[model samples]
Target: QQQVKQSPQSLIVQKGGISIINCAYENTAFDYFPWYQQFPGKGPALLIAIRPDVSEKKEGRFTISFNKSAKQFSLHIMDSQPGDSATYFCAASMSSGYSTLTFGKGTMLLVSP
Candidate 1:
């Protein structure tokens, strides 16, 4: 119930296209769902997030579509860009004190020019 599973360890999307990645978890106790985007040798930054209470969340060109009953969520990058190429991670964590996140193996996105 603590694992977040992601697919397509790597992906190549042309610039101006859309990049999609999927993830699922088993833990119903988890309250926060966040996606982090990381560049080489850099720490992951929170891109966008959605609580279980919400069905979806969007930030600029990034969007998160969540499915509560299916225990799944996905990240959609609209208008993929070379600069958007990075390692994306899906994570889950409980709201309680000191809850560390469980991250997916990671999906490397490559946006070609």
Candidate 2:
């Protein structure tokens, strides 16, 4: 079973500010951490991800950091903008074999213009 906890159900960030979201899991079997970004009426898209073997991964303005010892990870959005407002979900899954993803409740991010 996957027990993942995500914090700060919602967040407000000003344009050009940085947005941070955190997540912690209790399952060591999880090997992959993927952050999904969802818009009002669209499916969630993979924003960034990090594997257990790596400490962090950065893509454009997004970043994901992993802490294997703590079983925690976080997503950071640099230079936040009004268009970046969306719901972010932190998920965990096994990279190998067949496994379903365990997702946190999700964090609603709002960036003001």
Candidate 3:
């Protein structure tokens, strides 16, 4: 079964705008949620992540907002740029000593100038 669900199969944003992506999970066992960014012909790279212990986490222009009770999370990109155009994925996994990620369907973001 798909553990995570992501919305807005595609998004378009202008330069300097903000882009948002959202995801939700039904499994309470998921303790780690991470968002990944992937460009063409490349593997997904970890962008931002959050543990249920924290409500939010931020790194530079990337931010992750987590809601444990609701089993939801979202990613925000500040100052969206053309270079930021890529496919984004939200993933969930248990920190059960093994590193395995179940990813949601990707969202393709286009940041145009």
TM values, all candidates: 0.96, 0.96, 0.97
Q: Could you tell me which residue pairs clash in candidate 2?
A: none
Full-model lDDT, candidate 3: 0.94
Which portions of model 2 show Cα errors greater than 4 Å?
none
Lowest summed lDDT window (length 10), candidate 3: 93-102
lDDT of 2 by residue, 43-104 (tens): 99988888999998999999898889999999999999999999999999999998688999
- State model 1's lDDT: 0.94
Which regions of candidate 3 are displaced past 4 Å?
none
Best by TM-score: 3
Q: Backbone clash tally for model 1?
A: 0
User: What 10-residue stretch in candidate 1 is worst by lDDT?
Assistant: 1-10
- What are the runs in model 1 whose C-alpha is more than 4 Å off? none
Each candidate's root-mean-square deviation in Å?
A: 1.2, 1.1, 0.8
Tens digit per residue, CA lDDT, model 3, 1-113: 87899988999999999999999998898899999999999999988888999999999999999988888999999999999999999999998888789899999999999
